[model samples]
Target chain A: MKISAQEEYGLRCLVQLAALPDGASLTLPQIAEREGISTANAGKLMWLLNKAGFVHSTRGTKGGYSLQRPAEDIRLSEIIKVLDEDVLNKHCGSYTGVLDSCVHNGDCGIRPVIIGLHALVENALSQITLAQLVGNESSVDAMFHKVHSIHRTVEPHGV
Target chain B: MKISAQEEYGLRCLVQLAALPDGASLTLPQIAEREGISTANAGKLMWLLNKAGFVHSTRGTKGGYSLQRPAEDIRLSEIIKVLDEDVLNKHCGSYTGVLDSCVHNGDCGIRPVIIGLHALVENALSQITLAQLVGNESSVDAMFHKVHSIHRTVEPHGV
Candidate 1:
């Protein structure tokens, strides 16, 4: 499935926040301009992140948005969950015998498969912290390889 | 993200094939009826699966469709890839200042995130073969939980 625009923009903005120098904040307009999104859209995205407690806003001439805690304390999965609620609930197609009937029904065989997939994805996301996301590209690449290399290595033993 | 109808139906059909008794095949109409899909749609879905070398069919009236290999040898990743080609190539949003001028861009910060995610998902799916899909429900649940548990157990050791 394709990543939604909200996820892409919200995440890029978060990374921008993590990359910010000490005590610095970025305004909605600056975030939109740098992230290639509309100013109005930036305000909406910030509202979401702020509500999730992942971001904090200040008031006054120098006021803007900043991470509520150190980037190291934030989890990428938490940010993603706020930006896309459907990240966990997946709509697998119907499998009961009838399309929409008054009577006939049977076990929906495919639901478990989809559920399993969603769990696998959520689990993977939970393992990745924001520090890993905003880290150097080489380490990020290593994390990617890590997911592939580690899963099967111990599976043979008793996964 | 939602699992596509193609993924759901196609996978269900593959499980049906894997469940078939030795040398026994189910025709398109049989699969369509059993899976609650229309014959026309089932034909199209089968064509995709066949092209991926996951299924084979016979010509006579009694002849029908069956798994191309033992269910244990067929990977779920292969089936999912056949149903949804975009499983591997994710469209993480553009990062270049000029959104439409992406031709000049090298690598966007978000692409690796998506690529890593795709790899993570694929690796998880690769661990599961079709035999596991057609197994008992309890075992199916075990496989799902396995993905979540195995990923993080050893990453801290070296990853």
Candidate 2:
């Protein structure tokens, strides 16, 4: 399975906005340079984020994009939902590329596995705020490690 | 996120083989018809599965395809690995679609979240055997409910 390009890039862009000082904004050009994406792509992402109410734009010289709300209040789950409503639908589509429905649409063995994973992912993302992701890679990595250790102790999945 | 077509079709095809009686096998046509896929596509999927040592094929009119090992011995994790060695790589690719690497390659905040989700998914799939998937949709769905309820109690993620 894989995260969509829009979800990944849009999230990275938000992390950039999250890292900004309070009330500060970034231009599309700056975001493009920092994220290594085309300016047009960055603008597209920012536009979507803006329309989703996760970000607000300012006009004129020195004006740019900033988080609409505090980073601490923006959950990754919310960001993902804004970026792609078809997260699970995209997965289900793989079962029948040419058809609109799957052969096992009524009762699918794979459905439960996919749904369970989705719920777990949603739970994990719900616990993570963009504020948490504002840290550099190692810090964010450490945070996940801590959470995972706690989860392991609680469940002890012997995989 | 999305499961690859190869992974989905390959697993479904394997489930068909798993449901066969002892010493029984199914031809490409039979598999395709049962799964509502094209015969040529079925042949492609079976070829990959056979090459990965998950299934064996016999020649002649009465011969066809069968699992190389018992269904109970085959884990969903193994099936996924056979179908996709670049599963995580594909996700990483989404970060910088145009460039060879990401801007935050050295210290990426998103890396940990993706890695953590991958580990969780792997752990969950590892616990599920192909034999478990041989059941029809509802039985398999029920099985996941039991597992998920146990997981919920053990972890109690509020989300």
Candidate 3:
């Protein structure tokens, strides 16, 4: 299964906010320029994040958006849930349907297996907080280096 | 992160085969009827499963398909992988180049969290086998009963 662009962008935006000095806010335009996202899309993403209570936004000059809580308190699961993204494998007779039509139907023997899988995924996601992520600056830097290397390879020869 | 129709159908078909007596074969039509799937779709699903060495199909009159190995040996992960379906929250930066421009870039703190989630999902799926599913009838019965109840409630009044 794939995560949608909304979740991806939303998480990135949160990470950016987490990196800033405590209580500092960044305007949409500023964040957009720094992250290379279009200001329009950034505004939209920020709006959603604000609605989800992850960020608080202000409208006037010197107003922008800042995290509602410390980064360490926000779990990846909450971010994903707030984005309302579906993270399970969907199929006609799988867990998505009425309990009966599912291949396991009454007790069709595999319910535990699927449920266990769901729990494991949720648990893993819940364990990570924004604090842990921002704390590992070295790892994040290495990842950026990798991304840059890839970008250099993909750029047009003369550009 | 959704499971595709292929993986779901494939697992259902395997369970049907496992429920039968050892060495007893079932034709594509029988499987289609039992699982409420179209013959064409069954054929496609079977082709993949056959190629993966999960089942062996015979050629003419009285010919049919049967498990190539014991049901207990077949893991759900194997079926899903054969279909190129991954039940994990994949990052766009890891696969798509254009998305790397997202603000978090490589240093997005949440990457490790997502990676951990992916590993947990994979591990859970890997542990379930067809043998475990068919070993107990009660669980299967319960699943079907639950689905049936939901169907009854949702069905149109006249129908």
Candidate 4:
């Protein structure tokens, strides 16, 4: 599986928000200029994030765009789902085959793996709050290590 | 994130091989005809799988190609990794920025989450053997349940 460029840029946008002072927000022009993406593209991403409730816009001079919830409460899954929902949810059973339909259908073993992988990924994404993304270097390092150690512990054990 | 069409088709081709009788193999033409793909493309995938040791070819008149190892030992991670190695390894620390470079290379919070998710996906993939894809319905159902149960068990506990 591949992370789409849209997901990358959208997440980077959220990171920009997380980096701002507690109450400050970035205007559309400022975001586009800083990100080296065109204004139109930035606007599209903002609209998506906005529609998804991750962000909201203000109308006054002091207003622009800011996160709707605390950074710590925002999940990466939300950001990704907003931008690449279909990509993230491609179940194995849905694969169209070269024939009239997939020959495997309900019998494919890979289906469970894909579905299970999706669930695990969704779990990991939900657990990782935006707060973790804004943490200090040591804290972030600890988070990575925690995940890795868990992976190691899980691999050798069988059901 | 999205699984590439190449990864999907290649895996499907392997499934075709897995479904064959123990000593019987499909030739290049037969494989293409069965999968409804171009012969040249099917040949490319077969060559890659052969080089990777997943399949072997017979050079004689009655020979074609068959699995080199037992299907149960051929992990899905091996297949996905072979097809998506570069994508899987794209780290956040290496992300190019809109500016000359990222402002948070050494300390991005999202880096850990991506890496962790990658590990989890890898772990899940490695757990699934190719034999599962060709299993009976109940066996496949059990595989899905096992993965879900593992996810549930893992979520609340911290190391």
Candidate 5:
């Protein structure tokens, strides 16, 4: 399994927006320069985030894009869902062979293992909010560790 | 993130070989038939497995392919490494933008989180051997749960 380029860039741009001051916004050119991506690409990413309700854009000069909600309210899982939905669905259907569904549809050992891993990943992503990522590298790193620690602590034991 | 078709089919094919009696082998047609894939595709997957030393091929009317090592000795991490090395490497390099390396090479919060998640996934894969997947769906599912539970319990807390 691997993270797609769109997901990576989109997340980085989101983190940039999260680090901005309250009510402040970033233009596409500004985001592209800081993130080292093309302005067009940044606009595309922002468009997607906007459509997904993660970000909002204002018109005219002095207007740009900002988070639609508080950074603390936005989860990585939601971002991944918006950016990687097609890829995830394609992954689910890829191993079914030439058939409409998997050959082992009703009884698949591998499927459950994969599904379980997906759940674990989603759980981890859900625990991390954009606010947690809005800091210096060390602080963000620490925040993730803290979030993951609490996540593990409350995991259903022997379930 | 998503699992590639090669990884999926390759793992399923390995599980098929793993379920065989010791010294027993399966022809390309047999594997393809059981997995609902084309014989050519099965042959290609088997070729990769053989090249990676996960399986051995014997050329003869009665001979076919068999596991190179015991199922219990073959971990999922090794399989993924063989199948997805290129994709994983590309994933690492994809988000570096126009620079030769990532702009935040030494101080990237996102990198650490991704790296940490990769380690977590690899650890989980390492804990699961092919033998554990050579059962019915429910039994294999239970095996994964048990393995994951032990894994979580042994995790270094607050580290």
Candidate 6:
């Protein structure tokens, strides 16, 4: 199972917006630079986020994109869904069987098990908001920095 | 995220073995027939399960397979891992450069979020043992039966 770049970029874009001063709008280019994503891809992610009601955008030189609601109100699950990405494996079960030839016929023994997994993930993602992610950036940066330091120490000693 | 057929098949196979009379051995063909899976797939799945120490296979006439440990000792996570299928999404991060280059480094920001999701899923899957799923089959069957009956009743009523 894999989460595509779309979901990752989308969340980062949201977090970037959350990091901006309250009531301030940042253009796609600014977000792209800060988050280390491509301007075009950032724009695409923003368009989808806006369409999903997660953000509001304005056209023209003075206008740009901003959160439609408070950062805390936006759940990671919402972003994932809006990006049309699947964190769980989307096998035949989630599909509307073409020509009505689903192998399991909707009662596949494993369907409930996987669905339970999906629900658990959804619950966890829904609990994390843009506010939480942005607020914790410094901690994340510090952790990555520590990891990088450890890597340097271990690689030089080969221990 | 989606569960692979390997995991789904592996779990069902385990449940089937768990339901067997003590000390009884079941051949791959028998399992394939009962589970409505192809013999080749069943054999492949069983080989992986055996390699993971979940099952022991006998060779020669009347040879078959049996559980290596008690049903209660086998966790769903073990089965999934043995099957080499990830039960949750694991994104490395978003593409920092061109897609081809990103494929090499995989330093996407979303990777961390997905890793967190995987941990939660693994935790849940690890806590559920084969015994729980096997023992709950009766209740699950009853629930499905109820739903089936409801579907039958509603089918004729052109809603």
User: Can you tell me which runs of candidate 1 are displaced by over 4 Å?
Assistant: A40-43, A57-63, A90-112, A138-144, A154-159, B38-40, B58-64, B90-110, B137-147, B150-159
lDDT of 3: 0.65
lDDT of 1 at A59: 76
Alpha-carbon shift of residue B142 in model 5 (angstroms): 4.6
Off by over 4 Å in 6: A1-5, A23-43, A58-64, A84-112, A137-159, B33-37, B59-61, B84-115, B137-159
TM-score winner between 5 and 6, please give it. Answer: 5
Query: What digit string (tens of lDDT, one per residue) describes model 5 on residues B1-159?
Result: 777789889999998898999889999999998888999999999999999999999998898999999887888889998888655456556334332455655434477557556655565576567877776456445544654444344322212
Candidate 6 docking quality: incorrect, acceptable, medium or high: incorrect
Tens-digit per-residue lDDT, A1-159, candidate 6: 345567667887887787779889999888888777788988888988998899999999988999999877777778887675543434553543341434445345555556556665555565556666654444333323332333233211101
Mind giving the per-residue lDDT tens digits that candidate 3 earns over B1-159?
A: 444567667877888888889679999999998777898899899888999899999989999899998877777667777776443423555434444545556555666655544544444455456776776645434433332333233311111
Cα lDDT tens digits for candidate 2, A51-90: 9999999989988999999887888878887788656556
Quote model 5's TM-score: 0.82
Tens-digit lDDT track of model 6 for B8-81: 78888887897788999899999998778899999998998898899999988999999999877777767877
What docking grade applies to model 5? acceptable
Q: Which 10 successive residues of model 5 chain A have the least lDDT summed? A: A150-159
> lDDT per residue, candidate 4, B1-159, as tens digits?
666767776787888788888887889888877766788998888888888889999987987888998887888889888876556545443433322356544545455555556666676666566766774534544544554554454332121
**Candidate 1 lDDT tens digits, B95-122:** 2234453421553555566767777767
Better of 1 and 2 by TM-score: 2
Error of 3 at B104 (Å): 5.7
Predicted structure 4, TM vs. truth? 0.79
Interface RMSD, all models, one decimal each? Answer: 5.3, 5.3, 19.0, 5.0, 7.5, 16.4
Candidate 5 lDDT score at position B104: 53
Provide per-model DockQ scores.
0.34, 0.33, 0.13, 0.36, 0.27, 0.10
Extract clashing residue pairs from model 5: none
| Candidate 5 lDDT over residue span A36-153, tens digit each | 8899999999999999999999989988999998887887879998999665456546334432466865545577668656655665566567776665446445534644444344
Q: Is candidate 4 or candidate 5 better by TM-score?
A: 5
Rank by lDDT, highest first.
2, 5, 1, 4, 3, 6
